[model samples]
Target chain A: MAKNLVIPIGPQHPSLKEPACFTITLEGEKVVNAVVGTGYNHRGLEKACEARTFIQDLYIIERVCGICSHIHSTTFCQAVEELAGVEITRRAAYIRTIMAELERLHSHLLWLGIAGHEVGFDTLLMYSWRDRELVLDVLAALGGNRVNYGINTIGGVRRDVTPELIEQIRKVADIVEERNKYYIQLALSETTLAARLGGIGKLSHDDAIKFGAVGPVSRAAEVPDDIRVTDPYAAYDEVPVTAITDNHADVFGRTVVRVLEIMESVKMIRFCLDNLPEGDIVTKVPRKIPEGEVLIRTEAPRGEDAHYVRSNGTDKPDRVRVRAASEANWHGMKHMLEGDYLADVPIIIAAIDPCYSCTDRAIILDNHDTGEQSVTDWRSLREYSINWYKVRGIDTSKIKIAYSPLIF
Target chain B: MSELIAEKQALATILEKFPFLEGKLEIQRRQRIISSALERPLFEEVFGFVTTDGGFDNFHLVIGVDDGDNLGFIYVLSNDDKVMLSLKQSAPKSNPAIKSVCSVFPNALWHERELVDLFGAIVEELPEGPTYPLPDGWPAGNYPLRKEWKVEYFDKVNMTYNPPVTAGKEEE
Candidate 1:
């Protein structure tokens, strides 16, 4: 019998872009046990949301995930709107749907690139990211920012989908659709992709449900629990959207699902643009929502984005709970990581598209790790980084920086 | 069938399957969201029934709320392509305990770990995990989400080490 080796893979590592630590216990090359640790980026966004007014929280909530900003704000606004008993016009719904799908397009493309990078397929990474810019350009044209597009408001959208914007989105959608078709063909036909990813990170259909996996991770396991189709919001009920599923139950399954879904998003964008409705974009909803609780579930590109808003008939909410798609997927991560080679860990984590900043909503600063000098100010952190990098033969001491107070 | 009838049928179907849920559940039309209130003791039983016999297997999320005297919890569960149900329960603020359904719904453990941190929720058999979403070595006895809790509670940590003369207070 051999003793298991414990290996830690980061709160900060080369493989993971975000901050999360996965402690993997391995027997030679095979992972015998895996424990996923996250908490390095906790920002207490929910607590912040509670203290601010609905209007103020809109900006905070939208900034939850830089990738799927609109979906988070949409869920928050829909919950508030439901509590306020306000009905948005069809034009508003359609525009919101367009934004949501456009977001999904960009998000899935981003994931595709990340997944490719994880698997050492640099060409695919280059291709997907290059095409992703087109989607980002359309989003920027509509909302004035490439990311964190604040197009959503309480009762309706802040900006209307103009004729020029519609034409621009349509052109972008066509290009993305054509490119994703090639990716879809590559995902299905590429023997090397199948061989490398086919049996890797295999999560069975039953285990996917048992572990409460969401998004393409669950969809890859052949579970069609898509919030977009199951509980439609915005213009999803009107737009022709179908849940994409694959039976591979591995990283390849996730890749296939995301590529196919990009095509579906393109189809949705074209449909919404062709039948663009005309009317008022914003509605007159109250500043103070009534005393009630409403739960909103919307499909983010990753998976189900659920928001729970409880109002006390006041301008600010009583409680705002956000269950990002990645949180649910994290529950099933241990199941995915174990029994695979340690080398396959990064892609498995990437397959779920873990967003640490969104999930870490409790709190950050360790107020009680006493007696040990931790990062107190920008200058100390800079000094520590320079020393640490100098030890690794990288001289960062040449870069001069200014001292600043802790922006707590 | 009309949306109202479909919603009614959905509610009736659940009520018929679990007699304990009959008086506690109501559906909101157009939204197709059903909210059910259950006592804390029955929380575990309801979780079992729904996942096994009651046909609601997909557990989405568990939200813990602090309501002054009592802490409220809402469990979001659904069937595949079916109606969404928010099952609610509350415990007194003094205890704020919840039965861990991780044995049935493996995902509840993560949400429960979060409840332990932000709301000071005590879950029986929570199966040891990290103090999620909260940095390691976070001060105990401070639950930030409760109405009574303020950032001032951590003033001891915040007050340490004065900043440089050039800081946020400094005029550019």
Candidate 2:
């Protein structure tokens, strides 16, 4: 006789840093169904953008996701600039591209480290993370901050890469190239790591295209849908984008695509630096935006980051809508989870490199039939714990525990 | 196939299809621009330009823009050939609902939801489901993106304010 068991993975799991819960129904070791739950951290960014001025929105937008901060701000600013009929200088466009590609490098390395951790490879994780710090250091030197580089504005970037910073980036990229190659070798080598990931969580090209997967996820499935190549924004048009694709859409395939893409980004960064255009980094932007609407899309580290800005001749935008890439990639979760073992769930989710903070907020469910589906908060968990104790008939008055003072 | 030339040809093709689309469509640079009088047919017209023309291949981004008295939306479409189209659609601010484009591109699901959230524009034939972002008990008539909506601390308080209800027993 076989029995069904339900397993809850996350909302607090070690493998995932994001606050998302997935309940997998298992018939023995095989997962039969998986339901995803989110909404742990809801910042309400889109709604908050309404209150901010167009310039202030850039700072708010950068907080959408720390990993892809620059792209988010860039996309938002580009939309606003387009709406206001402001032309960013060519040098600024190049600088934006360089910054975006650098962000990609850091983001990909971060994902690589997490992917390594997911597969139980701590050594690789440590190595990848250590190398990733170099890229962050380079970003800090260029943008004056590691995470949310307040470089992008409406017309152009706020900060320019000085000659010293350019030299620093080149030197760092060289070191990163050497260290990244070693990490790649380790990730690709060792039969155990390859076996666990190579064929797992396979998404076919047809399914990938049908589901509208973007960035490396789709490219890994052999669909060359790169926004950088398709829609060249910033200096991407100047430096050609060589998209990497793999016929196999497994976890390992996604890993290889990201790894190669990082190399491509490194090359593009070097190319941009060597051929850095000579001009002003910023063009003046008007305070009052004309009444118009514009849609802007740029390649965020994970996938395509898009922003829509509408200006009704006001400092604050009338409406701004952001469509993050993770939202589009979430559709494939069901397909990826089907037929996979419970152990593989973390890896499958990590394969997409989802930024839940940007895609969704805390989830609330209500059941109308019983009037029971009220929003479940942490307090409800406490209430359930009290009920559990009551059901067990624990004599709280009889039991006493001694409290110990802090040793320190 | 330069970004500038491709953008120009795309604008020309769009203008040729709807001659009235000429003056309304404004090109900024290689891949950025704005359009006026956005509607369902106008979106279909732009979609036709993308699918039919070998130049424009992918739909990268869709943004819903809400003006005080009118609602406008923009679609950022791109092609492997280097052209980018920023197509705009608009509806009356009083009744800001438009026909759905889920049939043309299934990816419009989230984009439309974002539009609904920010612009309060209803996409006809939107998948019947629970509203995202907005809380269940969020005031029905309140649209946050409207310029008239002020930023008050009370709104944040109400965001977390869910009326309590009695828990149900397994058996009566």
Candidate 3:
């Protein structure tokens, strides 16, 4: 006998941190269908960027996602610079590459920690965060800030990596490398984790390509689609990146691919440090950008983040459209979540390392005939979820709650 | 020569039936930038050809730009040729309706909804998505991304606006 139940999880929920909701229809324990609704934390950045100058928009785009802030600014700056026809120096490119790789390290480690926490392995969460600090320490040493290191300027990088900074980064990379070995061993060899994540939330190779899955998510599914390798941006042409892929497309495959990619990032950072170019970090550009449209795509920590900038010969942009990596990756999540257990939802959602804030800029007005759909505030959504669980005989009072801002 | 040229030639041949598509198609770097002021009737035919025969299999991103009197929708698609195909179409501001390419690219469901919500461009054949980014009870006609749209604060708490007094006013 099949009992069908529609379970709604988040725009605001304790299990997920981001402002995105998953409404999964379950037939007993198995998920019959799932729908994801994001855009709760929409900041209207693309529209806002049109009002601000190219320089001001750098800071605005950096706030897209705190985790992948560097990549956002890097991609935006690249697009604007390309429009202005200003080529930054080799040193600047290498510095940008180093920053980008360091960001990937921090972001993947953060995801690893969250994945651990979701799977009830608090030890991995604790250890990964402890190691993650090393990457942040390196970032702080270079850019003078832990997160959103305003390092990227319009023409080039704002900060220069001195010999001392390089040494510090190298040391941190060594520590990260050591920790990576242990994590890889644990994540791959541990039978408990294998039982939990293996064969769960599987995205087939065809679906990954068809759905436009990016970064490690696609790579984990054995799709060799990496922006760094395919279209070399920044110092990638000079310092090539090896695209790491795993045959397994499930949650475990995603974990393995990300963990291994961290090691690859470590190697790339070392290469940049070893072959640091000697030149000016920035190039002087005129106040007004030349009238043209340009596209800049960079490999963000999560995936291939692209920005389209249209300049109308003014300091202010005519239009700025950002196609976030998570936007492409979310389709993969929707494809994976169906036919899985309701319990596996949290870890699988985190597997893509989705940044809902980065992805959801446009508003969606859902008018489905299901009659199950309704426009509810976070307060109402939270109350509804609590009542929903109570009806299922779960005690809500015992659970400790954490709150994130619902900034739509 | 390259697959890029072959794809371009194939696209030109397929699009030869519509004269508007002429001079609008060109290869920018590795990408085929197809920009044209498409008529409502021609939208599906052109988009379908590109998706099926043109080998622009992957649907990347769909962005709607407000051009004051009209709204421009850019549907970017790509294939193994590693070239992005940008299919640009415009809808009049008064009507604000364009044919949805969601059928051509199934993954474009969210992208089409974005056009509907932000740019107020009506997408035909696509169902409405959630009123996300904008909360429910937001003014019906208020489209934030529209150039003419100005910011207005709704009194959620029903508080009266009190002007901030100058720091030296009390002392003075």
Question: Candidate 1 local accuracy as lDDT?
Answer: 0.82
Candidate 1 Cα outliers beyond 4 Å, as residue runs: A356-408, B4-6, B13-23, B30-37, B156-172
Task: For candidate 3, write residues A1-408 as lDDT tens digits.
Answer: 756899899878999888788999998888889888987777788888988899999999998888899999999988888888889999999999999999999999999999999999999998898788677767877887678789999889888987777777877888889889989998789999989989998998988887778888889999988889876788998996899999899899999999999999999999999999899999987779998776777889889898888889999998999988898888767789988889999999999998743222123346676545445543365567779999999968565423211211
Every model's DockQ, to 2 decimals? Answer: 0.55, 0.23, 0.38
Q: Model 1 — TM-score against the truth?
A: 0.86
Best by DockQ: 1
1 versus 3: better lDDT goes to = 1
Q: Which ten residues in a row have the lowest lDDT in candidate 2 chain A?
A: A399-408
- Model 1 deviation from native, Cα RMSD in Å: 10.2
Docking quality class, candidate 3: acceptable
Task: Tell how far residue A407 is off in model 1, in angstroms.
Answer: 38
* lDDT string, candidate 1, A1-408, tens digits: 889999999988999989899999999999989999987777788989888999999999998888889999999999999999998988989989999999999888888888888888998997888787677768878887777888999999999977777777877887788778889999999998878788989899999989988889999999987888877899887788889999999999999999999988888888888877889999998888899888888899889899989999999999999988988888889999999999899999899988743222122345465744433443354467678989999885564423211111
Off by over 4 Å in 3: A1-3, A356-408, B1-20, B32-34, B152-172
lDDT of 2 by residue, A206-299 (tens): 7786566778888889988777887777888789789888877988889888888888888999999988889998888888888866667778
* Fraction of the reference Cα-Cα interface contacts (below 8 Å) that each candidate reproduces: 0.92, 0.30, 0.54
> What does candidate 3 score in Cα RMSD to the true structure?
11.7
Query: Sort by DockQ, best first: what order?
Result: 1, 3, 2
